[model samples]
Target: MPYAPKHPCTYPGCATLVDAGNGRCERHRIQERRELDRQRGSPAARGYGSRWRKARREFLRQSPLCAQCYVLGILRAATVVDHVIPHKGDSKLFWNQSNWQSLCKRCHDKKTVQDGRWK
Candidate 1:
């Protein structure tokens, strides 16, 4: 099979040619990922440390079915513990068990988009 033509790296002034599948060159790709990670901070820094993990495990064990799926007459196994309300750096809200819901990945992703958190 013939390969797709190579294209210039889409990182500003760099003219390095890369495969069509990659928008940026390898170097630029690494740089972009590092920048994103720096801006995003570590999971612990965002308050999902050991305490959150233990609480999440217990919550999932007690509520094994997706809340949204249950509402829709489905019985999907839940994998994510989502905040009913966005914490947005509020420690009190972040640790509120009453504001938590068990959700499957699909339902959780949909809810995240609806909550304007994925954009």
Candidate 2:
């Protein structure tokens, strides 16, 4: 175990070295996790429990391509099951399959910013 690989933090412009398997350095990891928590709240609180997970799996199986990427002429696989319209705790809206869209991480992040979801 004498030779370990090193890489830059996933955070933008961060020079901290982290293990290859890790996404970010300790400090930036904490900061990013805190920000993500504040934005998304708890998964349970956001109605994303076991039931949601099951639905998500089924949805992804049905729509395996990123909708946004497809619209942009790219054929990326979908990794996130996103609500086309934010549910915002509305049960009816939350359960609507028609409102669901498959998105890759990149498209999902862009959509989150555009939807003002991270503010």
Candidate 3:
């Protein structure tokens, strides 16, 4: 069988050649798919629409202290609102304010990665 014509991989700084119709090389294509799947399973995919945004803003307005930082004797301001237990696309769990906590960016990122929710 004839090999498909090749073109440069469209991924940034990549020097690999990919099939003409493909935007990324084989390795990069697989990486991209994994990244996309991560996003698809993220909270953003669970309808974190304007209502959620507004709720976050309001939650922060009411309490701007980082919950984790507070426990650690650090008085860091909260920059992100986090879900204590993952909602996992469940509307009831997602909207439960009792399950929410405020966190700083660093703390939120750490928790996200530790909980396998990082994209």
Candidate 4:
């Protein structure tokens, strides 16, 4: 099967050709991730510690399909457990199982963008 064609990195002034689906070259990707991490703080600081990991795993096991996609009549496998309402550092809200929903990466990203959580 033919692979997707390479394209220039999306980083401004970067002429590096990267595989399709990647917006930035490897170096820029690392730089961008580091910058994001610096701005967002560590996962543990953001309430995503071992406990969150365990809960996420159990939730995903119980709800394997993306809730948003399922509502749209699709059966996409979920890889993310999203909080229906932004917790905004509220531990009670963060831990509320009723506020959680399974979502695939694409749906999660779209929701994040819509929620103004992604920069």
Best candidate (score: lDDT): 4
Estimate the TM-score for candidate 4. Answer: 0.71
- Tens-digit per-residue lDDT, 8-71, candidate 3: 9999999898777778888887898788888687556676778889999999989899999999
Model 3 error, position 50 (Å): 1.0
Query: Model 3 scores what on Cα lDDT?
Result: 0.88
Give RMSD (Å) of candidate 3 vs. truth: 9.5
Which scores higher on TM-score, 1 or 2?
1
Full candidate order by TM-score, most accurate first = 1, 4, 2, 3
Runs in model 1 lying further than 4 Å from the true structure: 1-34
Quote each prediction's TM-score. Answer: 0.72, 0.67, 0.66, 0.71
lDDT of 2 by residue, 1-119 (tens): 68678989988999889998888899987898798889878887789999999999999999999998898899999999999999889999999999999999999999999999754
Ranking by lDDT: 4, 1, 2, 3
Query: Which regions of candidate 3 fall more than 4 Å away from where they truly are?
Result: 1-45
Give the alpha carbon lDDT tens digit for every residue of 1-119 in model 4. 99999999999999999998889999999999799889889999999999999999999999999999999999999999999999999999999999999999999999999999765
All models: lDDT? 0.95, 0.91, 0.88, 0.96
The collision pairs in model 2 are none
Compared with the true structure, what per-residue lDDT tens digits does model 1 show for residues 1-119?
99999999999999999998889999999998888889989999999999999999999999999999999999999999999999998999999999999999999999999998653
